[model samples]
Target: MTAPLLSVSEISKRYGAVVALEGVSLNVGAGEFFALLGPSGCGKTTLMRCIAGFETPDSGKLTLKSADLSGVPPHRRPVNMMFQSYALFPHLNVYENVAFGLRRKGEREEAIRARVSELLDMTQLAPFGARRINELSGGQRQRVALARALAPRPALLLLDEPLGALDRKLREETQFQLKEIQRKTRTSFVIVTHDQDEALAIADRIAVMRTGKVEQIAAPIEIYEKPATRFVAGFVGEMNFIEGEIARDDGAAFVTSFARLPRAECALPQGARATLGLRPERIEVSRDGEGVAGRVEDFVFRGEYTLLRVRVAPDVVLRVGAYDGRFAIGDDVKLTIAPDAGVLFAESE
Candidate 1:
């Protein structure tokens, strides 16, 4: 149990009458990749800025290695931030941009040169070091920004949507690169992102926020498979929710839906109102009438798989993922789900 690299305790912030962060607290383990994830206005960015000294909390404390950092300035704190914009100096070449931080600290020219060269090589930018910032591609500039942020060798690095500027293909590629670089550097990273997929792809743990409070904090798989709330279940990925009340027939428990569903878990008592969550990919659709009957209302091909919207009831449309794309609109189909594929939560969860 090594001490956490950074600890935020009961931190709160406000903008005039608007509350930005409300008693948000969390710990960042040494060398861990953590993410603050939520949609806009969820207080994620505010918390990140508080850590970077760009914004001050109205109460609570921030600590680094057991020392308080209440009055520290941004540059004086043992942290650096990489903005979504990359923030590379237009007038400087890649090498000089990375060397900017070290040179500001009055390091000897030889030492600065050595560090800059090492970072460039590590980031795979050795061949592009002499090119100006405008000459580099979006991904190249992102690497340059990362190299510059890591140049100072700070205790922690804060990333505010580091990959938001790139196209989908490049963004996915850079996510792996970012994870690899973090592993190599072994520096604690706290990334703030609204992109759920990116956070799930890269973060060791994620804190899902909403309305200036944390909804849940856990590993990606846990958050997706065993969500703490209905919001978490719906937000992390695509889910089909069916509202029903628990019922008992003979010795077995079931939910009153268009098709009676066997209990997945026994936490809720019989007659209690609850919602059943089913992931699109977990459902199997067929035309042989092996399960609940439904009609294919519409579908869209998504390359690796196809999303079929099936109408089981007048108001209930369930989204199902089919790998074969064999069904078409107006086709009658049957949908079946494994007993353990569904999750049950209270109606108000």
Candidate 2:
């Protein structure tokens, strides 16, 4: 197997007393589309900045192709960042904006024009070569920024919320185009975004972050199906955190108990305090019957599926998705969690 393209080793960062990242280590393979995903203030941006050489880490090392990147200036590194704001030059037209970096490197005018035109054509912005930045739409401007960032043909590309500025429809369309571009160019892309759908749609692997730390890193489907922590389970998608105490472990299985549910099966773990995490969609809802009975507090008829807020207990209101059956508010429902689908997370962590 080929060596990893990038390896982050025990990297830590701090803004005074506030710890922004802690011993976070990850590896990215060549040509892989990696994503850093989390809500705001989770240090996702900080980690990306560290990788891009915009922010220096307090401890540990960053390596690209086994070479340390410490003290390497952002401009000197073989990595380029596409900012969230799409920092395109206002005065430069599309061609000039895309050619700016090539010119700075002292490339001949013919080479600059050729490369610029090629990228413009690739991004489908060739016809807008003479248009000023202000004349273009948000998606157009975004493509310009991408072309500029990719102009130098950097080995690794870091994108920070690159689609946040566009409308939903445009963003969705651009997402596919971005993925296609990456695939064709074979550039190692690292994108940071809080939009789960965007990350799931484009990324080869996602590093889910929370509170300055990485909660989990895996393919989107694996992250959704088997979350490593409670934070990850709740962050990636809607989940019901049912408080449960481990009743027994037979070295191969576990049992849990709650007031409304008894002996719920879980993965074997020798722990007393734990929480059962079940995804909303993993639950099967039916008329009040054998499973845990609950009264539907509210029902929303979404286009593809229905969302029900079920009051299972006085204090716990679990969100459940019903894709088939339609239930009215105050309707009694039976909530059943697939025994194999429920995940057990150790509460202490």
Candidate 3:
């Protein structure tokens, strides 16, 4: 009987024969940082646009604060969008850029200045208010965009690839600032991103979309540690899938050609085809141990961990995340996996 802050029900969109969204439905609670994460062309953008009223769904309904959004224009809705391009006015200085929405609404100069000052301080752009948009750095420009979007105090804010333009180093640093600002403002944020790391870092919940459908929706840890489906397991993180079938003889293990996998943490029916989804960090690589023997096919030295691709069988390869980079190419290694480190997904036909 009660309504959420934002609700989308069975929203479907089709561009001619191509289906951009199919029965997509989700809800964003007040002050929740939700992420729409997926690869390109998965319809994340379409769903966000539909929420913003820029694109109307053919067969479903959206409600914000229990009010129907049907036929509502984008600007009329109590929602603001921060585009991927930042969309700041090049000629308008930072202060004016953030104050544009308030001025457009004909707010008195005194009130506009106060609200703009508050947002600038909250977004850490107070000192840069007088700077031209063209003279600001990428991260500073992003802050201006955020401050502008939040100035209107809309119930919801839609961000389309907000950090896509920033370099990796800057993007990583800005992620913390973004989340902090969102927390301080308490505005519900729906961010569309292709970066899994970004989603894991910033979102309170993530909806993993594929082929226009939401495959799974959960907290980031739930998305990574207990993915609901095979598609979700593969999409959210670096998962090593061991193809096997459920074996009834054992308590509940995937019967793989290489070996009978450790008892799966998840339940699967007997004789059902199942896939074991293991994170690289779950498998420990050692020179010698009571574990599966495999030879290192190759290895890459990441800053915090060494990722080793080991051939454990003729047809199976497992990636192990090691804290040390002592592994060399063609070296024999042992991969130790705990019984509960992996979750099993029933393979669909």
lDDT value, residue 35 of candidate 1: 96
lDDT of 2 at 145: 96
The deviation in Å at residue 203 for candidate 2 is 1.1
Model 1, C-alpha of 265: deviation from truth (Å):
1.5
User: Cα RMSD (Å) between model 3 and the true structure?
Assistant: 1.4
Off by over 4 Å in 1: none
For model 1, what is the alpha-carbon lDDT of residue 284?
A: 95
Worst 10 residues of 3 by lDDT: 259-268
lDDT, residue 224, model 1: 89
lDDT values of the candidates? Answer: 0.91, 0.87, 0.91
Candidate 3 lDDT over 55-155, as tens digits, reads: 98998999999899999999999999999999899999999999999999999999999999999998888899899998999999999999999998999
lDDT of 1 by residue, 209-324 (tens): 99899999899999889889888888899999988887765443555557777755567777888888889999998887689889999998988998999999888999999986
Q: Residue 65 CA error for candidate 2 (Å)?
A: 1.9
Model 3 TM-score (2 dp): 0.97
Q: For candidate 2, write residues 103-145 as lDDT tens digits.
A: 9999999899889988998999999999999999999999999
